[model samples]
Target: MSLYGGMNTAQGSNSCLCDLRSDTMTAPDGAMRAAMAAAVVGDDVYGEDPTVTVLESRLATLLDKEAAVFMPTGTQSNLASLMAHCGRGDEIIVGDPYHIYCDEAAGASVLGGISMNAIATQANGAVSPADVTAAIKVDDPHYARSRLLCLENTVGGQVIPLDDMRAAARVAWDAGLFVHLDGARFFNAITALGCEAIELANYADSISICMSKGLGAPVGSVLVGSSALIMQARRNRKILGGSMRQAGVLAAAALHALDHNLPDLERDHANACALATALTEMGAGDIQLGSNMLFFTPRDKNPDALRIHMADAGIRIGGQSPAIRMVLHRDVTDDGLDATITAFQSYFTKE
Candidate 1:
């Protein structure tokens, strides 16, 4: 099967097409591969992987954190952070649709025995301070102790405003809860808000950043936090079997992505906006544009039918109708974008 579940040519097809399924579909380019090939290797389990150390330190400095630790995936990174912050039977407040609650396989609860208090998120993807206030449990013995507040930026392709995030974090802090940010799309949020990484980091006690998404690394995520928190997360990482040996090759790709691919996110954002505008003009779908993602809902055609048509025309999309997410990445070209636009126009015109 294709890396993105059951989609694309991996389902026994021969078409090498434009894939809009997710930014996770991105592959490392030539320069990234070169960096990985030339990386000086060492055992990360012993804290001797220089490349990994550099990547962690760079991100820590950028986010203005005291320390950082690399993990195999964002799922593990976020889980380790949770395990470090809260003990068994403790509770964390999170948005109902956020990845930590809906996705991640409920790792926090399953592995750490941490309870999740899911609150309704606003349309803009921000959990209100009032919701945070309402969710915090008292010192009563009957309720799970609320120990953490988790927030995600660029949730479902919407950037939660910094002011909103600060307000939410303030609420969490006042309630004696630590804040964790699932910033898998951290750079996308940074580009959208035109803010420095440290500015965003100021609102959260810890952040989990995925390099394999828009950053275009082959694999790896990093958790950045205070030195004590990161040290605890490192121990949790080892316990979760996330500690690595000879991990510099993977870290090198992430380093290359930070140096090279991050600046191109603005282009991806522009492409997403352009595609959203085209779909809007064609009356093809209900479009919601967010940074580097576009949600398109077909107005006059079945979503499955549209999917097959696009696939036949050498384009791939994900999810079922009424809304399909199309993500722009460093790998998707302007020609691919034009071809995708043409494919949609042809399908709807024929209808």
Candidate 2:
């Protein structure tokens, strides 16, 4: 019963599984709901939504950007950013495993007529400056003009070292390319790196911050960058149908999360470390800890069987091939972590 004993949602029954799928599963708490209900509303399309303005401005200042725009999701936010940064027929240099290239449905190319020239990523998720330099296309008519370089922080839950990120950005800037960062887990990276928000932000021309991820906001992602770029993204947002009215309800939740959940992101990281330590000690296969996320392969090398066993034990995990990631977030408390370890114990130690 302790597996999901601390969950705060009514959507799940009295007896529920401890969900370790992703931080996206976190629900807005009572205080966040109250803030949403009490939020002031306006027409955001017309730029009159006060709460949304506050959220955008707060992030802009926090990241030392000239402006920020809120989007319904990080995917759209990144797409808008790519569109804003790259022109039609222009190319972007990004890591092959980055969310922009791998997960966002290649919207930059599909919708924006932009091309992604992917460079291989290291185990720690940092792209080499040499690869970036080599990936940039020549100024000839045959090649797509490389106009932007995209990077992600806390890729697979591991923080990209600050110096490495800066070096990559320097290569892009020297080549006259704009730098865009998929900062979906922005706060988690900062907590793990122990640096100020601007320190990680200074190198990128634009950063997409997703509040709904580990920050525990019900929904909202912010794109912070230069005012001119943001102005263009607003139009892109409208074209992409990301423009919202009376969206202060969602913005209010993000504002609340910034105050309460953002500071406590470290708790999730600690829990992840604990899980990794326990699983490693128990001879769990290749447990990799990344910030607040951990990746594990079943000892039996049967992910399907592991999924079944964990589910039977009141713990829910993803069924990703090779290895599955178990995320730690605000909703997953110490008790949930203990339950997860206990479930692993039963399976790995059995027979």
Candidate 3:
């Protein structure tokens, strides 16, 4: 793709710097490409794609879900999940700054007519159960029906505590609302918690797991839930025009990621910790470290200068946000970390 489209042309950017932008920046290596080439393809719209079928089933078993469906992107997977769980004019309660709210361009509202009620998240990224209880609308036509509770894991790089999730899910479930987990960084959270995937997945009725991020797949996300819910999601996928014809090519890379890249997640987390320590020692401003992500503001408070400095040093960090984020993934090598640290050293005048 890059050869034809020039999407990933070195242009000095890929050759020189480490990209601390996002985990989604990973590119498929030769082995993953080989797997994609070797995949047995079929029309998935008719449910005949064996590779897609295997990938979905593999994820379902991993999270102990009854079924799973592959989607082109996490946003589509999440949007379809919302549509599957809620009817028109229904409400979804989620944490503020969560992907479903701040990102994804409000597809649930724009496309599905589903409304969102966002609760301010505490420092650790867990919504207060008391706040969730208050956010539930009373049974009245005056308010959109509160139908689902959406939560995210790896909130700010730390796993949301299991007890907090249980408390909040209980509140939503007791109120007759379904639960959905946006686990775009699902494996990162599980790896950080050192718990079985089912332990975290058990909190939600449906789960969206993205393989493109951190897991090192070039593309693909899987939504897992009960058979009936997945059936509904499949219908919604068709409605959303996400139904694919020969997606096994993408699924094959995802399967390879699950097999080869997942075990490397903890290494990414370790790299994050190491980077955080180096930056903190250098007095990098306001550092927030989590599993495989670090958010920091340079002490000079000039992200523009810092970004340029790192770019010159051959390290690509994130945007000009007040607290810039740097993500560590399987594609980020030790040399990349070293270059990033050296760039920061020059920025901080420590060297």
Worst 10 residues of 1 by lDDT: 5-14
Candidate 3, number of clashes: 1
Question: 1 or 3, which is superior by TM-score?
Answer: 1
Give the alpha carbon lDDT tens digit for every residue of 1-351 in model 3: 221122353544357558777888888989999999999999998899999999999999999989999999999999999999999999999999799998889999999999999999988998888999999999998999999999999876867988988999999999999999999999999998888999999999999999999988888999999999999999999899859899999999999998888889989999999999998898778898989998888887887777767877877777746778888988898889998888888878852
- The digit string of per-residue lDDT tens for model 2 on 1-351 reads 222222433435225457787888888888999999999989998889999999999999999999999999999999999999888999999999899999988899999999889999987999999999999888999989999999999898989999999999999999899999999999999999999999999989999999999888989999999999999999999889759999999999999998888778988898889989999999879888899888888777887778777877878776576688788888886677788899999888883
Model 1: runs farther than 4 Å from truth? 1-5, 8-15
> Which pairs clash in model 3?
17-314
Q: List the lowest-lDDT window of 10 residues for candidate 3.
A: 1-10
**Candidate 1 — which pairs collide?**
none
Error of 2 at 216 (Å): 0.8
TM-scores of all candidate predictions against the true structure: 0.97, 0.95, 0.95
**Candidate 2 has which clashing residue pairs, if any?**
none
Estimate candidate 2's alpha-carbon lDDT, on a 0 to 1 scale.
0.89
